[model samples]
Target: MALLQLVLVLCAWWRPSAPAALPAHAINGTSPAASATVSDSRVRQERSVLTNYGGSVGLSPYFADLQGRPSPTPPTLTTELTPPPPKCMDEETCNPLARYRTISGRCNNLQSPHHGTPGQAMHTLLPQRYDSPAVFRMRAVGGGLLPNPRHVSLLMSLAPEGAKVEGNSLFVQMGQFIDHDFSITTTVREMTPGGKSVEVDCTACSSWYNPACAPIPVPLNDPYQPPHLPTGERRCLPMTRSVGYLVKDSQGRPVLSQPNFNTAFLDVSPVYGSNRCTAEDLRLHRDGMLESDENHLLTKRPADDFPLCFTEAGYCLHSGDKRVNENVGLTSIPHWSDERLYQEARRINIAQFQNFVYGEYVPLLLGYHTAAKMQLMPNHEGYFLGYDPTIDPGVYNEFSTAAFRMGHSQVPKYITFMNDKYEVTYHIPLHYAFFNNTMLALGNVFDPLVRGLLGVSMRPTDLKLVDSLGNKLFMEKGDPHSGRDLFALNVARGRDHGLAPYVEYLKMCGVKEEVSSFADLESLMRPESLALLARAYEDVRDIDLFSGGLAEVPLPGSLIGDRFWFESPAAGFTHAQLQSIRRVTLASVICGVLDQRNPRIPVHALQTPHPQSNPERRCSELLTVDLELWRETPHSPSPPCTHQGQSYQEGALVPVSPCLACVCQPGGKMRCQCDLSGCKQTQAAEDCYCRRICGYSTPHLKPQYRQ
Candidate 1:
């Protein structure tokens, strides 16, 4: 009798309570009780389908397509499929005259309100080439199975040592920082009857039997990975397909397409957040400043917020992008004041960021010749009149998935920490810094890490990746076998997206006219690279876009190949604003957050420092954007001033000589000052102030005076 009573009590205690009902607003028009009834029935039906395939219902269509077999009958649902609700555009909320950009990126193009908004489909540069209508590309040109992604990675991605490049590590870091601002693909997640979403674990299922399982099986006697499992099974790297939905093409045929979780603009969405809700959460709601910790670093999230963090602090830094905590330099946040001042500061910061991307970053990545030839460089003077709303600014799938991934090759094996004299103090292996912030929380290592980035050169962009990335990426402590190969993952993701072959992109970019055989690429690729490609792929047309793109030689001085070079749209700014933005540089932006006492830095921070060509100088010597150009006139009536036979409102920049900039002051007066402050001066005339007969020749000279 006692044992029976104890068992009954334990069973009652362990019983879970029923899940709460969802609100009617969450399900559009359905009532709460009706939604619950329908949801319970739907869960049963979905679970039946999942059980039939051993928990891989999501991948059924893909396998059927690959095997040329009919798709399994889907379980009948109690409810009918309904179209999504129409998008509601609140004009008052998205004002055209508003100086700041919307958090959701809506109304960026007034003509097409949802052009660059999040959750929109990424633009396809060319037609997708899938093995079937809805399945991934799995067959070669001659109908044979394509080479395994792991085999391709092992043959092409390993290197004895990294080749050095002329650019500094900051160049690679900034590229990754900007790439996050462009596109982030969503992955599939299963929802339970309790309304909880969880990841679908494909690794526990049989390979290729479950539609969601696209595991890369390791070849026999692999160099890095274990040859076999303890149970005598083959080892496989797990990966899942990106979330996609079926859409009709021009011919009314269904095609698979992926959505970009991020807005397709370079608007610093990484710092500001992509959606209004996320943006609101990141703000302090006081003085228009972002929330930060006492140490001026990004604030830490709650203990239960990020379970992936494995540090003693038990939490990770919070930001619009999770990758922000990867490095210390990106974690620094700026303090702000009033609403107007905050808006003005954000505007100036974005303008300077855009200016740096075009004026310096793009030129170095694409080379000055290619950038100019493609008309991708910014104007030195006057306003940019090329703002066309008709051109969609959505990110291209080709660029995000394959071309921009070239940055992976530039990652060094280890991150170095240095002192004021550029001597190494200590270093950490690249894998140790992944998703771990223990080193950043200890003492004062931020400045030293930043100095190391500016002082050290990055590896050359090529086919080879470091051992840390190719063999031991994201490896946990004390576990040598708990790592994934990033190179293999990249190749697998390309096929999962059904992207076109490398030759197609080459033809689209006009890099090659005829690519019938591997011999045609002799001029563009080295002999060893060609041999490796031939060994991995059965045919020339079956090459993966990532593998082929990385194998080619970089264009003259550019870090990437011709296929990666594309023109970026210019932002809408006034003539005075453009002039001010043109003065901004990477060196100036880095200096803004550093300790004022030790503001010494390289003249060109993106390039490796040279004593004569690119020398170290005080931050004061760097040119920066003038925020006075963004000052707005008060609504109250104010007296106007005239300068150079033109009337201007208060706080407006007056048209004057190239070397002199005059601003309209209060009480109807004009204040004129020399724009070139740090230049060597020579008296040319009595009232003309300082003018040099030799002209401006310093590194800090204005963009217009660079020639």
Candidate 2:
């Protein structure tokens, strides 16, 4: 019943509506005079509505109800409800001419400023499957308690050794780096009488009373964990629920949704920081450069400033993303003096980062074929005209919680360090590297670590996790059991987020098999993996998303399965700008950072150094982004062209009609070409108006057509 109610609410929220046409002034980069029909206040209000609530104008009535106001009267088929736009939307503003993204990640999509902003709720691919409307999914399909996450982790994730993949450890490192760039779930905390927030300690009790506490209960006789105490108490790994907001379902019951602290785009938020304050803190405030030590490494923070730092140097390395301090290789990020230079530098860096992700990183991770299939690959030339503002580009819950977690399986037991000659110098166990920056701060270890990453092969994507992660994750120096099971935490986190079961995601990804029994998953999963899952889960339908997804057979030439592969939005770049950005490669970025002479690395940095396919290449051979393309040109006013009743600037795509391709030309001219392939030709050509707007096709329209 709860699921049904949640689905109904989501259905109402997601109901499709025709997006309003962009204002002529906004589209043509012209003065308000060009669109005199729309008042400035009205335009601002409309933009505010779109930005705050997404492109779905159908949500106005719901918003009214959500604000504790009387629900607006239902609209008839011919009319729509016109609720007063929220006051917050009226106050929210954007500068359409700004070239750089805001530090808060707002205004990237002009029509929807807050679409991918930090602290916004994550997009849900499917309706959440909570045990209750606002509770974690703790019950199995048979109305019994679900299997303990620790038990599942022990049965499925333990491996003596991990198999190596064709890619180097740098691939796994890059994945982790990119993962931090977008999604960071902030956990809930409690406040004291003085209003200071404190961490909710779930470890102090076997049964937690705090709603935020959802710690993993260590099962009895666990291989690595001690047995239950003489007082009949069990150990629990400390955990807290992610910070979330409660909204009303169709039945007026509360539904919890978690927010993502990072922006959804691949804008390198980890390097630049997610918000204005943090970005400013990391900046040197001169010449557009960030703070760094004399050696050009990240600036160190006072030991007392960082909660996780345990280094003897009485300080920890500071970064835009705090997680970078977890390991030595993880630290990876410029300038001009004027404010213009800072913005310009940020613009180019973001462009180059996007280019490498789409051009090299994604293709290698998803396999070139699959990447191309999903349209994730950038065009070698010409403008990418696939920008759609209506699409909510927020990170999906499934992707953040389950699919992207596949990298945890690829983590090697140790982080190896090698000399310039590629000779193994030393190694640090993965457990010891956590929260300890001693290895990074110790004399000249960064270069050796980079070499090791480039030289060592990463573990293949499989169900088995390395012993360090499966047994002693985040384990301190001497206490063998003073650690948590990462694999189990991953399982529990999914439930905390109320993610759907593995089978649901499989169906969503278009898997053909009807999975009623364990045997049905044989074609997709290994026999041993299936058996392990069978032993851990009560039913096939009850399998956690993270567990089942990791067990699936990897797609050909890809490290992950089909369900884990997802498409990212295209970078909205002009023809010349995009072409220049595409020149950037991961090798080039690495070369720019490495303080070495003639650093030789694989042309395809994400793959192993194959003699032929991915041959070793000097730093000079790698293609770097040409920042000259980003140089600011003085604004020169151009004449606007009028088409029908709208105005457009030269070279602008005119919104004449969907089936018609129209562009404004120089000298106040309008050029339109019609493609009626999907339209039925009637005796009266003028009466048959076939509409295809933003990929949505409408068969026939009357002569009185309006875009």
Candidate 3:
């Protein structure tokens, strides 16, 4: 019965339980007294009405009926959590000097070629792996006039096949495609002028992995281009790495390893496999003249295959012979002239790039802390950007020494080097070897030595020159020759596709003013005059004096001819005095007026300052009018290379100065005949004074001030 009742209750609750239950009660005839049953039924009907208004028929309302009650305050949110960053392999570390202590675990010195995450490599360049990285110590070596410590890099080259090495001399092997194969021969300790190493030794033996190897050289001869391969094909030279010892006695002659003073090598090269002979049908690669020992550039030579160890001032054995010194007139190459101990021996540091496209070529000399050291430092690594046929190869090698953050992607670094010669380019993968750890290299030297005395910071806009009183000495239309001439932001140069919005804003704010002629502009825009205007505005609250509001104050003109030259109708004096001021003041003008209609047509005064000959005296300024921009034929490429493109327009800033100061007249009072009158005597007499007699020239007496 309980089960049946429960089931009936459940069914009633499904659809308006109160009405269903009431009907069941009535059917059962157990309806409380009829009036009580009617009251109960009314209650059930009220509940049904309440349920419809409060919620859907059978649902419960979340809130109570207290509409006037105060609402609870919303909970406050506080802390926010950030996700952790990803981890990089230990070998791919940055700045090994300071941060190396924190890193743990064995690291592979063989860096990945792709410059990606360490250990998880995209590809490997070498096949064989070494057990431990080679260690070399550098100490300050001494040389003639050489001073300051240097972190120097070294490289070597391969002599062509059939090249003979006899008694410390290497003879070139002549043939086709026999170019030099350069590689980092060894690294030495920082050497200072007059600093001698007391002792030097090498320890911790190791063997080179993958033992670098290459194919033999092929003959150069294209049947289509003439000049067949001469001397036939030559086999690729064999190479080896080992540790060797050499001792020298007091007589400077080679001796077997003796106890007193001797040199031991960490790694040395022994003769490897027999040379490979070339075939008659061998094809030759062009000799590019790219490899060199002085610059640390490699040409297909394996890394560390041939290592050398030298005892301070002692001889090195088992190494390729050094070429004769051409500049110093010495038959021997550069060698350390000292007697001392070295912590470690020297090893080669090799680097290469596949699919290398070259553009600008710059011979880079290592930046040293001191001038003395700069003198001793050898030039290493000619960095440049790679460009082939199209562009002029602007940007060179990009190197970023920035620390590698966990999440941020690697940034492309930039190396800009320019001189008169051509440019070249190369790229560095962000691997352990080439992580742009220059900051770490910089840290090796003292901070005081590394930080430049000159500090430079650049903004999009040029700096505004202000005086001690916070007065702007230079304005948009101010003179460029004045000491107050601040470098203004050049807006036209910032039209490239990658510029930021703020740069455009600056360019807009610094617009060039329109002018009729350069002469008119310069008279009003001279640096000194602008400086005075800036000072006047700064000293006084109103800047109207400089804002074209106040009338120009007339400065006393120098005495000339019959009377003092004064501005007639001074209102237009500035416009008239543009280049004509030479007749009034002995001082020459320096500003110019640029013709707006035709930018190529420039009109200005030429005033060259002679500091040495004319100590205090100055001559009259000259008027200069430009007709057109000059042009020259672009530089022609060398023989066999045709001119690639037409010449581009280039602009130049040329200054023209006055030739003479004074003009002479016959039977007339002294007159200042400037270019204004075109130096025409007849016209000059009209504008300039010609000894006017005022009451007989007032007895021809000099003024009191002049007397």
Candidate 4:
């Protein structure tokens, strides 16, 4: 009887809906009194109306699509596939596709045109009936990649319009810049030379379909297909490149940078070699720029310069996908509101992108000491991560889906299009900022800051909280919001990809603490968020990846939480690749592209037209990459090492992979520790653990502190 009473008392205290006192260490770091103040503000922020509008976890009734597909089929328990055979891959009995007698997940891979084919011309995407979400989630049921999906509609709410954002709007624009490079989906779209498009049916793609899809695939439906390609061949992957031919830098060495793209970091084509169709398409795809005037420098395609569709139906606008499209407009078009001004604005924005990336974002993301150590500066052999013959960069799903999506929280509500006086000429809400083509047509406002031409300057987004738009994106004229919910889909997608839950990733990423229960999340999330999480899911282990990640507070000195620093080479992204990406900032790209021209832009100041922080200094001062270093060649023009061709000098401070140390041994030959350790479990485990602990990057990263 006494034990039962004790159990009842514990249960009372564990009531998730009832507010409980926060743990003593919940608000770590600050002094006790100060912590209390922070806690109150957080609680107030949690209870704000912004948290009320959108549903969390599962789809809200109002969030139903125009077609009546609701999110999440309740907090339903999942059914696991049959037990694996001794070797499922080899055994016909346990083969995932065996039951349905289908093999390739061809039709199953293409979901609805929810987000649509983002970077393509208007009228892109497969037929709704044939390649809908219903078909793909059928592929969802039987696979090792499948993890149980959790409905998290209870976590969302509308954001307060125009809250105090973190950085200026320029940073928000930068997110768009990188987003354009990385957000390409796995689904393909095929178009004919006559601009006719067809949805490729799966009759030829594979013999099996666990989802039991019909054979309705179309010919020439390749999204990445090259123009006039022979039939039966699949399109190559899209790469990040601007001009087909390489432009010479100051030293006559070739530097690859696209004129339309602000940052060349996102290689769209020939540079990466896989995205050939996108490259061919960017070369106007025969949809040549309306006129090939000087503004058409490297690219003359109408769809080349920032493709954002602005029509109501979002059908045949000059661009496609209105929200991200119009958002691109705030910066690319407004300031240079005339077609004639397009080239000049493009020049300045490109320069600014270069300046800001190298000078600020890189350092802000990877500590300055880290970038400097990597020797990321531009030079001939050292330029563009050096001409590596063996650098094949693959997109890691985790980086693509989760860590990179951090930009969504950075978008602000209303952007201030600056007038001649550097004051607001007008304010436009995010949803309404569609393609005002008249505003984008080049004859009107030329100067970015002119009265007729508005230079839209944006403030930063809330760092702690993700905007609801991040999860539930915009759609044209719908009540319950007919389009896709990025965050919700992200959670489900993460599960579909067979990703580990929130806590498991933390341990793998080497987070300092253990996460046994939801309460232990106090180190990361707010008490209110934790309580809400507890109410939404029966088990703490059931919390979805994004849900748990969304609840985390930004780590000190960083905008991202600990969950974002996932370092899994199995995902196909090398640690070296992460280091390489961190090194090529905006400044590096600008420096690589222009050679000697000063950007006339601010240093690390993303909020453009808002007064340069150091107006007196020239762009030269902001540049860390040196072009002259690349003037001389190495033993070979092509790098033998498989990396981004980073230039290194003694004491230049490059990242050291402790697990792959090349110590000199017997006859002047150097060997890596990993190679010497062989495949022994104990030694391999040590090397893996050491590499995982190689903490130059990440918020909760463990310090290797190796010189």
Using all chains and alpha carbons, the TM-scores for the candidates as numbered come to 0.74, 0.74, 0.12, 0.44
Per-residue CA lDDT of model 2 for 1-707, tens digit only, reads: 01011111111111111112111122223332210122334323321231121122211221111112232222221111111111112124776544456766677777777777777788788888665523666667875556667667876753233245577777787787788888988666666687755655666333244566665655434556764444555456666666666665566654567788787777666676777777778776654556666655566789777545556567766652211222121111112234545555565566666666777778877888999999888677544434556677889999999899998888766666677666666555565566656545544555666677777778888777776677777677667776887888888889878888889877877994467888889998888788778867758998999999888877888888010011111232334445656776767666654558878877877776778887888898777655444343236444677767778655455655545545555455655555343233342233233433222233333333333
Candidate 3 matches the true fold with a TM-score of 0.12
Compose the digit string of candidate 3's lDDT tens values, residues 1-707. Answer: 01011111111111111122122232224432211011223323321231121212211011111122222211121111111121332434433122111111111111211121111211111111111111100011121110000000000000011111110000011000011111011111222365642111211101111111111111111111111123322211111111112223355432111010000110111110001111101111111111123321111123222132111212211111111111121112123121100000000100000000000000011112332242332112211111111211111100000000100110111111111111211111111111111221112111111011001111110011112001111211232111111111111011000112121222243532432222332343434334433322222222111121111221222000000011111111121221222222111111111111211110111111123522322122333211011111236321221112422111110111111122211221112221222222333223223213111133243212110
lDDT of 4 by residue, 169-189 (tens): 545555554555434433222
Candidate 1 regions with alpha-carbon error over 4 angstroms: 1-94, 158-163, 191-198, 205-207, 250-254, 320-338, 561-577, 628-707
lDDT of 1 by residue, 353-422 (tens): 6667777889889888999999888777653334556678888887888889998988776566567766
Q: Native-vs-model 2 lDDT?
A: 0.59
Clash pairs of candidate 1?
Answer: 59-211
RMSD in angstroms between candidate 2 and the native structure over all alpha carbons: 18.8
lDDT at 123, model 4: 17
Per-residue error (Å), model 2, residue 344: 0.9
Off by over 4 Å in 2: 1-92, 158-163, 191-196, 228-233, 251-253, 320-337, 561-577, 629-707
lDDT of 2 at 134: 30
TM match of model 4 to true structure: 0.44
lDDT of 1 at 558: 85
